[model samples]
Target chain A: AQSVTQPDIHITVSEGASLELRCNYSYGATPYLFWYVQSPGQGLQLLLKYFSGDTLVQGIKGFEAEFKRSQSSFNLRKPSVHWSDAAEYFCALGYQKVTFGIGTKLQVIP
Target chain B: DTAVSQTPKYLVTQMGNDKSIKCEQNLGHDTMYWYKQDSKKFLKIMFSYNNKELIINETVPNRFSPKSPDKAHLNLHINSLELGDSAVYFCASSPPGAGGTEAFFGQGTRLTVV
Candidate 1:
């Protein structure tokens, strides 16, 4: 079955430090991958997505993700973490019916 | 204006009560979906509608029914709600065509079943 996995359940990073969230997926074909962020009491917001062309796709809020077909990974990265970046991140895979990962909670330390 | 909006941002109800959550999207997208976020924060797709037609339905129980009146509206109604039903529900919409596109999400409705 196709699934997405975010190995880390919770991560803490100091402000101004770089951040990377890992995501791995299992699919038969080259699948559509996405990263989304959800803040407390707020709906999810799309961070970035990978479709066909470039392996590295940039998204809103200075977020970017690279889709690696070899490892079936689409990991999100940010150069510098902000205090406001504290939120839950989810990795999803699919075109129409998507499967979401368990999600990783990020806590930014001041 | 909100691209995708769900009514009743917060809902607290007793078990066995029937309740409905309404969703509307002004983005003119043809596909809409309902996703459930459990207490553990695991998000799961429940149902999807494309142009008022049901396209994807997960293993959700029969007690949960979804109705789409138009392309911009999708509603979820739960019957005989259980304590386990307490979770945050989100409504989202995407443009027509492939599913890989980014979806607009509503603020979400936090349902607490007591």
Candidate 2:
């Protein structure tokens, strides 16, 4: 079975601070990975995805994720997070139907 | 323009009643999908359609049937809805060939099966 795990249920960070979210998955070989962000009362927006080569994949809204083959992990990183960046982030793995994690809720404090 | 959209942002209904949720995408994508987000906020795939053809059907109950009149529309009809069916349903679309491209998602329909 293919599943994605987001270690943190929620995380709080001050505005203009660095942020990193951990995500691990169980798959056979290089599976397609994706990161999605969802705001309150809104639809999901794509953050980034990793298909093949180039472990470092950049996405919109100053978001980026790196695919680690050995660790079976695809963690999202942001040098500095803004208040608008506070939302639920989901890490997924698959092609046919995405298997999303429980999601990590991020809160930005002033 | 909206790429993907679903009807009735919120649905409140009684159990044992049958209902249907309509979904349409204007992105000109060949593949469409239905996902159920539980109370825990875990989104899971329920069914998928490509070019109006049923391709991927997850472990969903037979009561939950997806009807695709065309490639752009996929409606989910539930027969005798149960309380456990109360959750957020989202519609998404992809280009084709087994989800190689990014899928565009709709705003989601919050179905409350009482």
Candidate 3:
């Protein structure tokens, strides 16, 4: 069965600091990977996705993710974190049926 | 306009009652889905429809049923709702094809069983 794992349950970073959220997947083949962000009382918004192109993919809100086939990882990163960046981040894997990670709550501190 | 929307942003009902949640998407996508977010904040896929046809149905209980009148609308009807059924339900949509496309999500409906 395909599964997504987000090792970090929660992460806190000061404003303007760099950020990285780890994600690993278990699948037989290179599956479609995605990073989504969910704000409090709001629905999820796609940050980035890796299908079959370059390893590094850019997304909205200055978010970027790198897909590492060797490690079965698709990690999200941002150079500078902002107060508005505080939210729940989820890593998902799928093409027909998707599986979401437990999610990581990001807290941006000033 | 909202790309994806679910009616009854919040719902409170007693156990054994039957309720339905309506969802609609104006993005003209060919695929729609229902996802449940439990109290633990774990989001899981319940069902997916493509072009109004059932495509993916997870291990959800038979009490829960999804209806898609068209490609733009998908509704969930729960019968004999139980306390364990209380959770936030999200409606989402995507373009045709495999999961290569990013899905647009609704604000979600918070269901409470009392």
Candidate 4:
């Protein structure tokens, strides 16, 4: 089935450390990819998206994602992590109806 | 001003009761959707309305129905709600397309069935 997969269910990083969240898609062709973040008691906020363009896409909150066609992956990354970055992250894709992954919970430590 | 908004930020009701959650998007987008976020924080697409037309309906139960009076408003009504239905329901809107574009989301409505 065509879907998005986030390998890591939970990740913990120290403040000021780098962060990477892995995402892979199993689609017949490259569909639009997106990364969204949800803070506690909040709605899902779009961090970044990938369409038909350059592989690397920059998003809000000092985040970026690289879409690798060969690997079918669009992993989100940040140069340095912050405590406020601790939240639930979701990777999604679709052409008409968007689908989301289970989500990855990030815990940032000071 | 909020781009997307859902009413009744918190709802607590008994099982077997019926309820409705209203959603509106002032962004003037043509596509609106209803998504259910389970206790585990897993998001699932329930329904999609484009220009007030039902475009996508997942394998959701008949008890859950979505109504779109126009392109700007989409409401979800649940009949005989069950305890298992307790979760955070979100309403989102996007530009005329699919998941390819970023969606504007409203603060979810947390529903509790006791």
Cα lDDT, all candidates: 0.95, 0.92, 0.94, 0.94
Clashes of 1: 1
Query: Which ranges in model 3 have alpha carbons more than 4 Å from their true place?
Result: none
Over the stretch A24-97, how does candidate 4's per-residue lDDT look in tens digits? 99888768899999999999999999988899999999999999998999999999999999999999998667
Better of 3 and 4 by DockQ: 3
Instruction: Give the residue spans of candidate 4 off by over 4 A.
Output: B97-99
Off by over 4 Å in 1: none
Tens-digit per-residue lDDT, A24-72, candidate 2: 9998867899999999988899999889889999999999998988899
| Tens-digit lDDT string for candidate 3 (B1-114) | 999999999999999999999999999999899999999899999999999999999999999999998899999999999999999999999887643877889999999998
Residue-level lDDT of model 4, residues B1-114, one tens digit each, is 999999999999999999999999999898999999999999998999889999999999999989998899999999999999999999999987543678889999999999
Best by DockQ: 1
Candidate 1, B41-102: lDDT as tens digits: 99999999999999999999999999999999999999999999999999999997644787
The interface root-mean-square deviations, each candidate in sequence, come to 1.2, 1.4, 1.3, 1.6
Q: What's the TM-score of every candidate structure?
A: 0.98, 0.97, 0.98, 0.97
A45-91 per-residue lDDT for model 1 (tens digits): 99988889999999999999999999999999999999999999999
Query: What residue pairs clash in candidate 1, if any at all?
Result: A95-B99
Chain B TM per candidate, please? 0.97, 0.96, 0.97, 0.97
Docking category of candidate 3: medium
